[model samples]
Target: MDSTRTNKLLELLQTIGLQELNSSKLLSLVDEALIHVSAGRSKNFERLEFLGDAVLRLAATEFIDQQYPNLPVGRCSSLRAQLVSDRWLAQLGEQLQLESFLVLGPKALGDAAAQATLQADATEALIGAIYSGSGNNLEPIHHWLTPHWQQTTADVLARPHLFNGKTMLQEWSQAEGLGLPNYTTTEQSSRHGDPERFKSRVEVGSRLSANGFGRSRKEAEQNAATEAVQRLQDVGSEINSESPNNTPH
Candidate 1:
């Protein structure tokens, strides 16, 4: 990489609080990943991406464990999935405006829309690069990602009932012999990037279980399912409380 490019990358890293970096391994990988084409040199971030995928998962798990020692395995798994998901990574990459420094080839440069798998891949590769540079250490990764991780964990835990609502609701329905839940979505706004772009209603049996709004159809439906799951949990709790199974066996 050129001196100007190296300096720019360093500046970006510093902006995100990676102040005392020990390794340049991460930066090299970042450069490789951002450059869409490297004809002669095979220094792409693909390998780093593979390594980062595992490292990110491990570091996220460690973060969750330290923050929530009493949290169950199932719950931990759910939280970890969200933390390491492509959507989450892409969101972070976009927030940092990583694409502004990307060195894309002619074809890849044409479609400059900053969404989807590319940014996510880059983010993971970045983690891998950091890991490789830091001599397989996780301290720097944790330090850089701690704030984002905490916020993400908080947002997810706050909506604890919303975790995998669709799957949970489906299982609950099947167990209760109520068949599959039906969902209907309607577009509230046709404009681009509207938060309340779609509204969804979920039905169990002949009754409307719940309704929710989201940026996309899937999100709206999931939100509705979360509502249903919350209702179900409340009802179940109440039922158990009232059941008279003789006094404290």
Candidate 2:
């Protein structure tokens, strides 16, 4: 690690509200954080995103379980989905002005198409960084992520009958006794110089039902499953609602 670069990054940290970080720990933290953010096709964010996701779900689950004891399981899952989505996280990052603080490769910075996506990725990467740097300290991250979660939760709770794509997809498959929807990752690219992309397909009943793309495979799979559920449910609802006597007996 370069001392000068490390110093520069430490200085940058203060601008992002980490005024209490010490140089030595910041060195290790920033090094790990950068490596994690820039890993794979910069795929490191995926793991951090995964960790943060788990944390977010657990936190949301605990909150709902304790507070909304009368809420159904589906509603709890819907609330969790709204709170932990990438779109909401990206909004939180923007509120924190996170884009200005990102340390990206020159190429990544130069691309217009990738700029929007970097915010979401960087946010997840930062969450990952926080977990790594702070020893999985939920307090700081919760402080950071809670407002975003709150707004999203409020929006979702207003319409408790609605289901998120992930939840809907799972329920649709279960209703059919489809033996659980399966995900197959078709492509994952994280080359150092290339933009990262993940592609996946969701299958049900030996049928390739949907395809999706994302900066991470998890995101892609979620999208694919969501699409599959939308299609499946629409079809199922139509079939179920048909008049029984009008149908072939």
lDDT top scorer: 1
Candidate 1 wrong stretches, greater than 4 Å:
22-26, 37-41, 112-114, 161-163, 171-176, 180-249
lDDT of 2 by residue, 178-225 (tens): 767788875566642123377778888774389877666777787777
- The TM-score, computed over Cα atoms with residue i paired to residue i, of candidate 2 is 0.53
TM-score of each: 0.70, 0.53
State how far residue 37 of model 1 sits from its true place (Å): 5.2
Model 1 Cα RMSD, 1 decimal: 7.4
Per-prediction tally of clashes: 0, 1
lDDT of all predictions? 0.73, 0.59
Highest TM-score scorer:
1
Q: Clash number for model 1? A: 0
Candidate 2 stretches greater than 4 Å from native: 1-87, 103-107, 111-144, 155-164, 188-196, 206-208, 236-249
